[model samples]
Target: MKKQFAIIGMGRFGSSICRELFHMGHEVIAIDTDEKKLSLARSFTTETFVGNGTDESFLEKIGIRNFDHVIVAIGDDIQASILTTLHVKDQNVPNVWVKAQNDYHHKVLDKIGADRIFHPEKEMGSRIAAYLTSDTVLDYIDLSADYSIIEMLATKKVAGKTLIELDPRKRYGCTVIAVKQKHQVDVTPDPAEPIKEGDILILIGDKRDLRRFREGELS
Candidate 1:
């Protein structure tokens, strides 16, 4: 299903979203105050506009209300971002997602009724911290304050063992969600499916269980 999207900023984050949506065959209206940024986004977006996003008249003129989803990706100027988001919400756009710079920014967006808030910097920091803190954790995604999904390399002890054989749920309270190999990804691995030394296991569960698994406590 295709949807119309409006992106209010042309910085790295907004540009990336515009490009991805366009590549996925969605209609994207990219708006920015900077002429240079608008020029850069021209080839990637379906439509480009140079205007002050916080201006309600400008937003109205551009048919912002027609968009199914609007992303407020304004960088640096928290005031502008908030104003734009408020205007978009006032227009009653069905969904509004905002990129927040910090905790304060997130709180403001939440109070103003943003459907979703993303902190890319904080998320990337967490991912980098996971890599730096442990050698076993190939990737980490925070599912909640106490839950996470971790991609871990199968150690020698776990190689050739099946889900039923290892029984991670019983031992560690975690579930193996998928197995990723060089050539394929198995989302529905059988209970008897064998694990290889180089296979990457995608597991989901409470954060404590993940930490225990990472420290080789459950091996």
Candidate 2:
């Protein structure tokens, strides 16, 4: 299904999102106060508007409330981002996703009812740190404060076991959702499929359990 997304601000973060969403077949409206930025976004977005996103009248005129999702990606100007987010919320947009400049900015957005808060730089840094720190962990995605999904290289001990034999959910509190081999991926991997040394297991569970699993308890 296609979704209508309004991206406020045309800086790197916002522009990247706009282009990706456009490519993914979503209807994107890119708005920016800078003429140059708006011009750059015009080719990638379904619609491009040059205006101050913090202006309530301008936002209303552009029908921001109609969008399925609204993203406030203003950079540097935390004030503008907050005001714009507040205005968008007042208009009763279904989902509001905001980018925070820092912890303080995030707190304010949280208070104002932002449906989702994103700290892209901090998140990217964490991802890079995870990759650098562990050879076994291929990737990490936070599902919630208590839960996470991780991709890990299968160790020698786990190589020949089936899902039923390993009993990940009962033993480690994690479920093996899929397996990624060199050239193929098996979604919802079968219980009878034997794990291989080079295969990557996609597992989902509580963060603490994932940490324990990474420590070779399941080896």
Candidate 3:
């Protein structure tokens, strides 16, 4: 289903999101105080506005409250970001997401009822660290401090073996929740199903257990 999104900034982060959401067929309204920034967003967004997002009157006039999601990506202007977020929330926007500049900024946003907060630099660093840590890991998502879900490419070490033979739950302390072979995805695959080389396995496990499995099995 399509969603209506209002992005109240046009910096690199906001512009990238606007383009992606537009390409995904969602309705996006891009707003910024700078005409140059608005120009960049005009091609990708359904609407582009040159105005201060912190101005509640301007926001209401643009129908910000009607948006399904509102993103506050004001760059480095903490006060503006905060006021914009507050106004958006006050208007009762269903989902308000913000890009926080620091820990203090995040705390303020949290207290002000921002549904989601993002630290792009920190998140990208963590993702890069995960990629550098393992060669077989195609993707990683931290479920908690101790648990994670990882997508690992099945290699010769694991090929031609059934889940029963591998017994990952008992041996590696990890669970193979799904497997992707070519374009097909098998969720909760049968224990007797053969795992082929080049297949991708979606596994969930404690961090330590995942590291052990990666070293003893994937390596």
Name the top lDDT candidate: 3
Cα lDDT tens digits, model 2, 59-173, are 9999998986888989999999999999999999988988899999999999999997888786542343344335688888977767878899988878898888878788888
Who is ahead in lDDT, 1 or 3?
3
Q: Model 3 shows how many backbone clashes?
A: 0
Clashes of each: 0, 0, 0
The TM-score, computed over Cα atoms with residue i paired to residue i, of candidate 3 is 0.61
Q: TM-scores across all candidates? A: 0.60, 0.61, 0.61
For model 3, what is the C-alpha lDDT against the true structure?
A: 0.83
Query: lDDT (0-100) at residue 168 of candidate 3?
Result: 81
Error of 2 at 69 (Å): 0.2
Where does model 1 exceed 4 Å of error? 122-219
Candidate 3 error regions (>4 Å): 124-219
Q: Write the per-residue lDDT of candidate 3 for residues 118-217, one digit (tens) a residue.
A: 8877554234334434568898888887798988888899888998998889998999999998999999698898888998989999966876777777
Q: List per-prediction Cα lDDT, in the order shown.
A: 0.82, 0.82, 0.83
Rate residue 27 of model 2 by lDDT.
84
RMSD per model, one decimal: 12.7, 12.4, 12.1
lDDT of 1 by residue, 62-150 (tens): 99998878888899999999999999999999889888999999999999999978786754534533543445678889788779899
Clashing pairs in 1: none
